[model samples]
Target: MMMAVGVAERTGLLETAVKATIARAPARLLPYVVAFVACQGHVMSDIAILVIPPLAALAFKAAGRNPVAGLVGAFACVCAGYSAGFTVGALDALYAGITEKVAAALPMGQEAPTHLLVNYFFTASASVVLALIGGFLTARVLEPRLPEPTGDGSSGDEESPTTEISKEQRRGLLLSAAAVGVYTAVVLVVWLLPGSPLRGEGGALIPSPVLSGIVPLLFGAFVIAGVVYGVAARTVTHKNDVPKMMGESITSMSGYIVLILVIAQFIAVFNWSNVGTLLAVKCAALLESAGLTGFLALVLFVLVVTLLNMLISSGSALWSLMAPVFVPTFMLIGMSPALTLAAFRIADSATQMITPLNPYLFLSLALMRRYEPGAQLGTLMSRLAIYVVPFLVAWLAVLGIFYAFDLPLGPGAGIEMP
Candidate 1:
């Protein structure tokens, strides 16, 4: 899948993958599937966010730009927590539970993220939008101002625009749309009307069935439709052309799957070792004893969180360990639960853009190779200061604003009162 995605056209390739993810789900959970998956790991991070590195690579590759920050940011967003927005899958349950005050930190807190959990859709979208802007800035400004870094992706694969969508392609699109629309209609009816045929039929709380065999439904729909359209439009009359297009997606993803499974095992082993628990415990003590408290304490906490995130990659586990003590402690000092959580998130999210312990950091390095060719780890780090400096300033300034005003993060959230 990795290589195929690397070579495939950006626009259609993601559509194919998105459909594949949905097509693989079961029918019972179809309602809330799209929004679920789209917002799935809504809290903690998930592997589905993995798509960022490749897709971000494609976008920058197309624009003739640097992909380091894009890929790193994408990976960091997923590994840390689920709110990074551009992707989703498992972090939702984990994050939701943490903020709900359920589980304890891996070591001390009663919850996983121990810190305040962020609203997924809100944060995730921010990551995507910010990443695009960052990438754009780097391509248009930073790349030219400084010495170019080394890279690992193929610059030779320039995507020239197609002259037009052939009739057959149009037909395929219509089919794809119809199939998705039917699935969507079912979900919305159930959610809004509540008396719809599909409502509460299974375990689903909401009806908007958007996935499950639905994605495969889209895969089948788009491919068949594309083929039908191809034949009529003279773009693909032969069986051979159809297979060739479909084959591209499968073959390219194979490497990615292999890498994912291996990483899964490594993470599993790390979790089992209780290292995260021990580390969070140790860090919590140091911070507490240092006598950090209230808003001033939060500044120190963020600095530490950002520093630790560089060494350990799991954002949920890190917060899980820290939030319990800090949240209640900060609350006692007049800070809001929501604001406390938001601080940890900013710190956690910031370091991923440049940290080394993150595994995907390597993948992004490879992406950089595609553009700079001679780009190295050292080089990427040196150049990142440009984007990071601005982002840090922008990111923290906003956080400072929230703290000063004692803002409300949402319902049942915010700073203190008299």
Candidate 2:
């Protein structure tokens, strides 16, 4: 995933795509379009936090709208939609792996499946809904409150130049898209054909090779698309360039890799001590005694996570600590790990923009100042705080609808333990 994103970033495929989308949008629908694209920025990871806001500001400026509104809206969407996306990516894998590990600590009668798409159905649906909410807020609520950009260049002494997609970039995007299509088609054929090896016993698609093997599949697709884009865009003239890009990507993740190691050790010790299981049983009993063993308990859990997120901006770090206790405790109370995970995701993301602890918040504020010049962090926070309630409300609504209908969170993963 890192390698693919690196290649895409290197070839400017991702930037070109964002620019192209904004270029074709109608003036009135610009916010809506920007909001939706921002939600999809998970593909670019942290770079999205840096890339989307400025581009959005520029696009809004071109459309004679408030550029600050565009900047804030994109930043809000990227943060709030962190754990929600139509596509399975690194976040899904990280959360799923941790959930699976902690879930295994408990001696449940049945195994809990925590594959890459464990929350796929819920998140994909939430992505669309959040996009709409983001767009509505940006267009009707945020833009109207902000002043128009004067291009006074209080910060730069000159107006920012307009962004454009070059002919080569257009060609690269087209070829990369075609590459993704061809790769997907081939995979579908291999997985869907009769007597396919990807299927499980009795030909079940769930618990099958295709689902379990998603990481490699995603890696292949991304690499193919990115490399194709790189070649077509003239970013890669030699095969060695691909490996160099991969090396650079891995190097960039050194800090994250170290963090993961520390987290892994903590989890291992927590489980080995047998204290996690004991705490979970005791906690579950306490919740049951309080008659809070169902939806109410999950609600409280979400609230707690939301508060903690303000202090600890790293979702992985927070989840690593919480999952050991909450996941098994929820499982004891008849909730599936996936259901508990879904709740954490909601709380984890819904309040993202309001938190000062987030590194991205500072980055976004810096970007905002590029246009607003005198804009302060507090100003950015206030604009972003306006987005929290609507995002939180809409997210809770979706969760309620899914839980009430007893819908599958993902393939073979329901709202309750079997």
Highest lDDT: which candidate? 2
Query: What lDDT tens digits, residue by residue, belong to model 1 across residues 53-154?
Result: 455444433344444543443343333333445432234334444543522323233311222223333354445444444544444555455444454555
* lDDT per residue as tens, model 2, 1-418: 6776777777677888888997778989998888888887877878888778888888887888888888899999988888888766677878998898899888782487788888889988888899899999999988888865545323465455445877887899999999999999999888888789988778877778987888888889888877898888888889899889888988998988998898889889888998888999999999999999878898899999999999898899999989999999999999999999999999999887888888888877776776677788898999999899889888888888889899999988888887
Specify the highest-TM-score model's number.
2
RMSD of each candidate? Answer: 11.0, 1.9
Q: What stretches of model 2 exceed 4 Å from their correct place?
A: 152-162
- Per-prediction TM-score to the true structure, in the order listed: 0.52, 0.96
lDDT at 78, model 1:
38
Local error of candidate 1 at 402, Å? Answer: 4.7
Return the lDDT, model 2, position 345: 93
